[model samples]
Target: MAVTVSPSRPHDTITGTPETGSQLTRIALIGNPNSGKTSLFNQLTGLNQKVGNFPGVTVDRKSGFAQLSSTRRAEIVDLPGTYSLYPKSLDEKVITDLLYDRGSAGYPDFVVVTVDASNLRRSLLLFSQLADLELPAILALNMTDVAERHGISIDIQALEQELGVPIVPMNARKGIGVAALKIVMAERLATHPVRFWEPNDELLPLVRQIRYYFNLHNDYLALHYAQQYRSISFLSVDDRQHIAELVAQSGFDATAWQAAETIARYQRINEVLLEAVTVTRTEKREPISNRIDKVLTHRVGGYAIFLGILFLLFQTIFAWAQYPMDLIDQGISALSELIQSSFAGPLVRLLTEGVLAGLGGVLIFIPQIALLFAFLAVLEETGYMARVTFLMDKLMRPFGLSGKSVVPLISGLACAVPAIMGARTIESWKDRMITIFVTPLMSCSARIPVYTVLVALVVPDRAVWGFLNLRGVALMGLYLLGVVAALGSAWVLKTLLKARERSYFIMEFPVYKWPRWKNVGITIWQKVSAFVWQAGKVIVAISILLWVLASYGPGQRQDAAEARVRAAAPAVATAVPDTTASQELERRVASVRLENSYAGLFGRGIEPVIRPLGFDWKIGIALLTSFAAREVFVGTISTIYSVGQDADLGTVQEKLRAEKDADGQLFFTPARAFSLLVFYVFAMQCMSTLAVTYRETKSWKWPLGQLVYMTGLAYVAALVVFQVLK
Candidate 1:
């Protein structure tokens, strides 16, 4: 067969010429999941990276720049991992789309396919398919260290000749063989000289028509187009229609053809591996992973272990992040004071009370966010996350969710935006929908600020069991409540939403390994950065707007209100000592001015609606402002409290503790605090999450329904808790 190369892309040969200009060579990194693809990508593009969306899709597209050689640099595009070109989920479909559509911006000049050296036959399935496409590609035989430990060995040169591509042995975990792989990538590319599968006479006509119509050279490529034409986004309506007509006329059986092709390809792979690979030790010694799984995966022990880990994780988040959080708070407070001292106008008040207060709230939670993601990353890198999914499958199946739902649900602890987006991995539409609907019920990092502030108000700071901190226990209790709420919500959704599609969970348990600290650090950096930058922008804007609303009124109501308070000050001075009375009078005047302000008026307008939940108008204002983001509640409270008070009044938590009703009762009583906590646990307060839900489900109906149901649940739950306790 003649290799058909695009005339415009003449550098398709094994020893292709490098680009002469500033254009970076594009390399597509493709692999199976857990094939060390992430490690290789990190090694290649240490910090030169940015994530984006695939063209016309919400699936994340992670690409980064790397200097492949002294003179050549490349943009490495990390495509979603898939076993083969046959697409399952939207993520896998991206791989098929990019490779199939040469005009796609993500299409690579060359491909680097990472494969597990120990699982050679299984991993090579995708590489073989790519080779058949005649794309210039190299095989990155990763996990060789693991293979060696397992007494599996391969002749790299022999395998390279058999596959007709360069095979670089890589222990990506140890950063081994990266240099060799870079040299190969920079200097040359290779295509499989031998085709793995040829179209039989029965399907020859269908393949030929597709090839001729699409002007394609490779038979396998033509076959893929014929099979995936309907799913292919680049194919126009006319082209898909033409292919459909051709397919109908040919009477081609796609399923049977796919089965035959897979069998044929694997048969060839078996032959090649037999010649180029060997196992030195075959004594059936159980692996260490199996031994460890015995205890970790046990029905009873596993759950205890999982809960213990969760408890430890939350405790660490509270303990480890406290110092940094306090430092950030103090620094922000100092800055606010400096602004108040430096300027003598409305701008200073806006800077201190609005902008600075909002920023402090966002920054204070960074340490906790970082620690949460770091723990998650460590779990993922060490492969325990897969075990968690496997362990949770039994519990999930009863609720009409599959093992796949566990990942997104667990990920919801970080943020629901990405967690909802992560539901794309669930192939079943019903399960995916259910997962999206319930994921926000999990308390995310955003809830940390709100929870910490509230928990401190109600829960004592002493230990519960002489070792476990009472505050930590309360925090974990809140998280458990969220999880329970999510599962309960899922059960409700299961009953309400009809299931038209079946759900299946097929997951592989990877061998346990030590966490790569670099990857962990990178994950923490990215997640925390996203939180601050994306959420911070909204917080700042809302803070400034809130300042405007709280600083002014419809007309002279605020001034008149403050004047009335001052008019009564003389009597209060006579009742108390002069200095103490003056301070109390100032405080009363500030309160009246805020109550007459626009935000206060709005808060009072809604106070009766939330009164059953034990919320007053100030808390009502916070509830409304925090709809933009849950963490914004603390900032809104801080700004509102700081509006007319001295800079030395105290932190938001202290101010909240000191707040009282006209009846001289503490405002944030335990009943009210826990009620608010429960409200936040169930409420769908995040607008961004709702927007992402709309995008993921491709319908406003689902998101709208989600908002209504969750808000209703929050209201009822909060009301019940407060009524029972009060």
Candidate 2:
């Protein structure tokens, strides 16, 4: 069998030689999920990292610059974790695509495969596959500390000899053995090696034919091209057609061949492990993880514990964050007053009432957002998140969603943008689409401020059961309502959008461990920072825009209203003979000016439509502004009421409490507050979420449908709640 070798291009080798004067070497870090890959990446890259989407896919691509040595700098790309090159999910496919397509921008010069030292048997499968690709590879044996606890040991030299790769045993969580790993990476990037795995007799002839036709130097590379030619993005139409014809002629059954390859690979792995790995001791004892999983995964006890934890989380978010939230609010209020006192004119009003008020609204929610993200990060770091998914899978399946949907739905509580992005893991289109559709219905942290303000207005803060605060209980009820709505919507979607193929959910349950505080802190920082920066931009812009609309109107209506209020002020004061009369006159002037402003006109136009839901024109204006983001509702209300009421210094909630309707009834009556709460719960008010939905679905149809259905539901539900309560 004659195999034609392609010319040795710089891009062909796993550790490609850098071009003259180019000081950077590109390295790819590949690993199975829960193999401590991200921990290692964070340790190596520190703050020099950037996250982006992979080409032609929504899956995240994280890359960072790492200084391997004094003179050696490397760009490390952290490829999504996968079990093997034959991908079962979209994220896993990223690994195969980048590796098989040398023309890909993410194509690496060398590969560092991180494997769990405690689970060598399972981790070696991917390492072996990489070796078969004829790439220069380093094995990073992470979690060695955990392996020691389990009485597992490995002979490093023997493993290196057996696998024909350098094995660096490291505890990534503690930053151990990282220096040794870097040194090995720097040394191995200088060499190019041939394929490590020899093809079996049955596959050799076919591999040779593939190599010859494709001009491939490596047999394994040819094998992968034969298997994945159709899905490989780098292949041209002509190349794919030629490869297809050649593959057809060779009578290659991709499924059968892949199965054979896997079995053969495992057989070789057993041999390697036999010579290299050792079980230092075997004891008849239950693992700590297994012992804990018994209770955590128990049918009755599990749910009780989960509910208790959720209650505690909400309680903490509401209770612990109250102090910080108040501080932020006061600081922002003081700053706004300072800015107003210092500057005079429209710019000052815009700065204090518009921009600063909008920012204050967003920043006040930071305490809750940070707390929620911190809890989520801790759950994920402790590996308890997987158990939650596992527990919810049974419930999720009945709702027409795959087990994978649970992850997105649970994460939706934080933010729908990434949660919707997370739906990519669901292989079934119907399941993924349904997950995206209903994810936003879950009240996110953005809704926290709105919910807190409204709930505090209506629900008493006293404890319900002498321990559970009524406020916390109300918050939990809102969260539960969202979950019910999501599942109900998914059920309806399932009945409407029929599936052509069967859906299957497969996931790995990682062993439980103590949460890594550093990883948890990094995750919280990233999420909270992204939230503030992204939402802050929209909030500030909307605040300024709302200010412009509310400050000025057509035909000098605002000027006319202000002059009329000034003309009546002296007569009203003479009749009333009290300071309250003067204050009421000023309040009336502010109300009249707002009623005649552009924002008021727009709100009145929609008032008839939303009036049955107990929403007046002012609330209607807030509804319009909040579409940019839900948290902007508070800012919109604050800005509208703040105009001309400069003397009445009050928080958004206090101002809302002071608002009165045409009948002299409180605008935020319990009925109105509850109705508004219900409306926000179901409304598709977030434009960012809609944009993300479009990006994920690659069409406006789904997001548009989502907006219409959710908005309609909100209106109808709010109407019913208001009518019943009123």
Quote the lDDT for 357 in model 2: 75
Q: In the order shown, what is each candidate's alpha-carbon RMSD?
A: 5.8, 6.3
Residue pairs in candidate 2 whose N, alpha carbon or C atoms collide under 3 angstroms? 14-109, 15-109
**Cα error, candidate 1, residue 98 (Å):** 0.9
**Top TM-score hit:** 1
Q: Write the per-residue lDDT of candidate 1 for residues 1-726, one digit (tens) a residue.
A: 111112232223555566677777899999999999989998899877776678876566888998988899999999988889988767788888899877776678889999998899999888888888988887888988888778887877667668777667878877888987887788765454446777888877899889988888777889998898888888899999999999999887789988988999999999999988899987588888898998888999998998899778767876898899889989999998887887789888988988887788667767766776778788888989788878888889988787778767876886786677557657666788899999999999889988988899989999866899999999999999999999998998899897433566777888899999988877777666665666567656766787788788898899988887777768757476588677667766666777788878999999999999999888888877787678767766765564333333236678788888889989899999999999998998876577568766656798899899999999999999999998
For model 2, how does the per-residue alpha-carbon lDDT over 480-563 read when each residue is reduced to its tens digit? 999999999999888899644456666687877788788777766665566566545665676678778877888989889889
User: At residue 245, what lDDT does model 1 achieve?
Assistant: 94
